[model samples]
Target: MTRAARPGAAATRPGFVWALPAAVFFLMFALTPLLLVVVLSFTSWDGIGEPRFNGLDNWTALLHDPVMIQSVWTTLLLTALGVVTQTPVSILLGVWAAGHQRNRAVLSAVYFVPLLLSATAVSVVWRAVLDPNFGVPAQLTWLFGDGNLLGSKGGAIGVLTFVGVWQFTPLHALIYQGGARAIPQVLYQAAAVDGAGRVRQFLHVTLPQLRNTIITSVILMVVGGLTTFDTVLILTQGGPGTDTTVTAYYMYQKAFKGFDFGVGSAIALVLVVVATLISLAVVRLSGYDRMRGTAEGL
Candidate 1:
């Protein structure tokens, strides 16, 4: 009996040993880089040179930087617009798609095409569309009158917002569609028997069931909006006079263009902190933790 028990314990030891490899991999690949960035955020370093400890100077400079302030404001604005625009559109599209099972695959594919495209590709496409002279806007201006959409601050930001929505709507739509499809047909049948109209059914049944999915999608879009860099960089280049520069772009400029790694790292740290806080706030407001079980059903 003792010898048989010893063999079983030896077999179990391999599983414990396998867990060690995963822990070691995570420490080496993930934790180490994060810790290095945190350390670098408090020190000054030119790319080619060794980092030197600078204490709070980097943080202090960040507080005083006008560009940094502007970047933060722009990031907030984009995030707000994304949440407001993307959530409902995705929900509506998702509801519609879920109802049309025969067409779901084709519609999902069409909607997801933009998402499959690279950031560089999106930028190039939009750049051509927004070109001041020979682009789609120019043709539209010829038909309308003096409507230089990308030439003005509001218009530029609006275009950026629209592009962001277009790119991300498919992702949100898929999320919502999955949620909507998971809802039992019995609920819809009961709602119909009670003479509930489309709007009321959506409001009372669909929306409540989708609360968790909406929260998750909104959080993802908010973080993406706040950290948007590639699209803005390619489309407006923070142009029309720094009107479109989000915090990510500012971080890039500071670190790469201005050779200020410490300040750049500080900005990156701020972005991480802000995104985390906002996500937590959304989860709390939406009662996502409480609804975790229901959401799993969807």
Candidate 2:
């Protein structure tokens, strides 16, 4: 015969009961605000009195706004640069660190230093360092006798891309390093027995094992690129004629500076949709969904 249930045992049993507090917190903080944003996006509010219902007006404006379109293109460009530059560098560094323990500490310290600095601090330091007259960049560009990196369109994008890559690649490297180390040593041994060299082993064994991690890293970096504003705002103020103005900063300007919260909310929601689509594309392109059941079957 089963023992009689203790008082409140059913309520205290192993289940989502323990998650109630966190679920409550998420509902109160996250879900509520998100719902409010969605509601507000459909209304016309100027951070003042009444929020009049104005359906799709802000979204319609976004479709034709040249500045919004430019900001979107800029955001995509930065994200593409981050993916292209950071992913390979991170994988290479992670592989190097995982394979060789001798300099791992030094490498990790060097790579992670930028991440420790606040974005504003980093931007301020870089701004000083890139000063056209007296900065290191000036000295370097003295070879060609043309300096002014922060002034030109291509140069502004390049600096923003460099900063994005510099700050983010270390996190991706840590992800890859963890993934590399988690791989079974027996697999490497078997690959070696089959005449696989280091490069071939990496290509065949390491990369396949780290595929999910890489996909996760790509999604994170892409999202980061889409939402990046603090560094660009602090450094360039989206200056040199909006060359570095990403959608995030544009949203901020519309919301705070221009006092157009409805438009900003629409832009924020659009960014959310765009980010979701891009993340799904990354997952599909990396074949993450296809790899799901194979591991369980194995």
lDDT of 1 by residue, 139-162 (tens): 787653565766778888888888
- Candidate 2 minimal-lDDT segment of 10 residues: 289-298
lDDT score, residue 125, model 1?
92
lDDT of 1: 0.85
Give the C-alpha miss distance for residue 68 in model 2, angstroms: 0.8
Each model's lDDT: 0.85, 0.85
RMSD of each: 4.7, 4.2
Stretches of candidate 2 off by over 4 Å are: 1-15, 143-145, 290-298
**CA shift of 127, model 1, Å:** 0.9
